[model samples]
Structure formats: C-alpha cells, structure tokens
Target: MTDLNVSVSRLSPHQECALHPSFKWKPVYNLECVFCQSTLCVRGMKAILLADTRVELYSTDLPPSGATVLVEEDYETRHCECRIKDIACALCGNIVGYHVMLPCHPCLKSCNNGHFWMFHSACVQPHERLDHNSNSILLWGSLPTSTQDDQMHSSDNLQWTECCR
Candidate 1:
C-alpha cells in the first residue's frame, strides 16, 4: 500500500472564492503542491492569493475539439469537463498539468498541482459563459530555474547566490 495525502475541506461562506464573498479554500501555508512546493510567485518571492491571483482564462490553440476527452459532469446548476491539450511553458522546457477543459470554470484550478484550466466571472466576457477565443490554453510549462547557490531565478545562471541576500 502507499500513502495518500489526507485533507479537510471546511470551505466556508463570506470568504472570497471565484466571485462571491467566501473562503479561498486552499491548503495550509497558503500553498499549492506540498510535494513540489510550487505556487505562482512574482517579484522573486511567494505570491498571496488575490494579493496576487488574478482571475484568468486561457484560450485554446484549438477550438476545444482536437483535444482528447478526460472527464465531464453536471450538477443542479453547474457543469464541467476536462480535456488534454498541448501547451508549452515559455520559461523552461518542461511539461506538466492537465489542459482540463471545463464546461465551466467554477471548479478546481490550482492546488498541490499547478494551476489547471480554471476561470472566474472576471475572466469571462459579459453576456457569455466562456471567452474561449481570447483565453490562453492552460499548460505545464517549465520549472523555475535555479543557481548553484540554491536560488530560484527565471533565467539560466550557473553562479549561485551565497546567502540569499
């Protein structure tokens, strides 16, 4: 047998979520993946949600047709579906994450996994459910580059920082 990550989802109301005042419902440490420990960072440091997270929607290179089927579902008022799409990261040459095509963006996005196909009302256009034409297809790009001194940087550098000053 293998170990599975245990978790609790005590998501509450009156916290900021996709649109309403509701909790963001993230794991402890305001983190994403505990294993890889990669959360969207900006300005050379950790990014706090909303403090940093802006609702975004990625338009697909294809018209949501050429991708492979993954999963789909419907609730009393919402629906979702996942698809596999090809994507490339601009920073480094690595691949990750599902191009999860949801019938809607109210579902999951980023977690222990990097941001997947997710969207909020702000990311969508008015009078429409999806702005697929303007959205960038979600993809696992590249891991953050690092230096010998154990510092994470965007570009390639052989020299490492001495003490992270």
Candidate 2:
C-alpha cells in the first residue's frame, strides 16, 4: 500500500489546496472506525467550520472557528437520509458520531436534507496522519489508551456549547 502519510511541508501545491490549512490534523486516507475498521470517509474530505466553537476529540481539541471541523458532505458509501443520523460502526454497531440537523433558515436553502456528518475524532482512527512538521505518522488499528485518556478529560472544564442535534 502507498504511504498515505506525507509531511505537510512536502505536500504538492495541489495537495495543499485540497486540505483546510486551518485544521491542526488531517487524515491521509478515508477514516475508519477504530473499533471495526469500517470505512467512514475518504482523506481530503473538506470539513465545514462551525463558528466560534471547539470540539473535543479523543486525543486532541478541535477549534472550529477557523478550522474545517465538521464534515457536511457524506462519502458515497456512508450516506444517510435521516435528519439526525447516528454514525455507527457498520460491523459492530458502535455509535461513533452523529449527523446533526441544521436549521432551515432563509439564508440556507441549498441543503434540503438539513443535516451533515460529524465524526468524533476519538471514535474513528485515521490510517495515516498528516503532521505539519514531520513525516506522516501511522495510527493504530484501534485507538490507543493514551488517546482515550485525552478524550475523557478534555471536556471537564469546557462550557456548554451548542452542537447540531
């Protein structure tokens, strides 16, 4: 298999363009559920930034203000029709994420479906990770215990923030 992990500084201009520079970490291939290894979304999938909020992933904190944190578009294989979809591991049925419902306001009429995909970084494991300063790193087939510790403690002092339903 090709080494999907590539250092950010060495990325081709085209590849850089494909990424949201504001995001701290990005996957090199489609993410898979750490529990079941079921594919979730492909690498280079653009995320939609929610205003003035941060999400607590398993190991890292995601600040969405200027980052591509929420995935609005679903990959072809993981499409859902429910207004509030549950993102589960296909093989194990472990709920790993959510498809939150977006309000249908006057300004937003394009997404008639009223929902988007948001996978918890803690629940899904990336096959390859893009490191800004060094070569891409390979993640484990399952989430590491240290990462779980990070996720578990990240929300302790956080103020309540609104997320999609």
Candidate 3:
C-alpha cells in the first residue's frame, strides 16, 4: 500500500478572518467511535476549533453513517445554556457527542444555524482508511491533550468560548 502523509496539528483558537488574513486550514481525518470502532466520519470533514476536549463537525457535511442524533434535551455549558440532542453510535448505542439545537447568543455565530455537531474527544478516535476497496484503517493515536501552559498560550484568541462539559 502507498504511504499516506497526514499532518495532524493541534487546533488553534478561533480567529476572525479580518484580523488573521493568513488562516491555515487543518487537515481532515476520518473518525470512528472509540467504543465499537464504527466509522463516524470519513475524509473531507475538517475539524473545527471548539474546546480542547471536543471535535466539531460541520452540519452541512454528510452525517455519520454509524451514528444517529437522538431527541433534544436541555444542556448547559460553562458559559451558556443550550438545547442539544445526543449523538449515539447506531451499532452500540453509546453517546458519542451532541448536536446543538438552540445555541446561546455568544455561540450563535459558531453554531452555523443549528448545524454544529460535537464529539467528545474521548469517545471518538481519529483515523485514516488505507484503501477504499478494503476494510483496513490506521488509527492516529489519542487526541491532543491540553496542558495549562498550552491553554495559557491561546486563551486570549478564543473565538467560540462556550463548550459542553
């Protein structure tokens, strides 16, 4: 099999385009449910910057084939109150993340019109499929763990401050 060169980088704090003209795009990766290893998202889905322990997926992208959004429920984050639906693994029924139904005012711009989906970093694993014709996959190890020093470095530039705990 041909070797794939994947550049995985820590997600930076969100910045407005007007202030940061040269924004770098993070590479996309396939994600799988950590519990059952079922594919959650394929390539072409880029991770958006949220909190350190969550992975954000766009609502416009194809929904995960191995998961489903459940009924909406009230949820509270550190900074705001919102309504969200739990995203569970279809194969195992494990709660992997959530879809924002009603975002708080500060999160409205980031919510993309209720199209934001978040996956717990601990519940999903980032991976790469070696070949589309086969069932082979390459796990990318654990998601990035944030340290106090790292948090201090980027705290001033955070765009989306509200996050589910």
The top-ranked prediction according to TM-score is 3
C-alpha lDDT score of every prediction, in listed order: 0.24, 0.39, 0.47
For residues 1-165, what per-residue lDDT tens digits would candidate 3 score against the true structure? 245443333444432322122222333455677897765554323445343225454321334332444645647665456666778866567887777767766666552322366666677787543422233432221112213223222322221131111
lDDT of 2: 0.39
TM-score of each: 0.22, 0.37, 0.50
Error of 3 at 162 (Å): 36
- Report the candidate with higher lDDT, 1 versus 3: 3
Model 2: residues >4 Å from true position, as ranges?
Answer: 1-28, 44-52, 56-83, 103-115, 129-165
Two-way TM-score contest, 2 vs 3, winner:
3
lDDT sort, best first? 3, 2, 1
Question: By summed lDDT, which 10 consecutive residues of candidate 2 come out lowest?
Answer: 156-165
For 31-76, candidate 2 gives per-residue lDDT tens digits of 5667856454433222432321264332122212211223345332
Top-lDDT candidate index: 3
lDDT by residue (tens digit), candidate 1, 103-129: 233334433222333322222221211
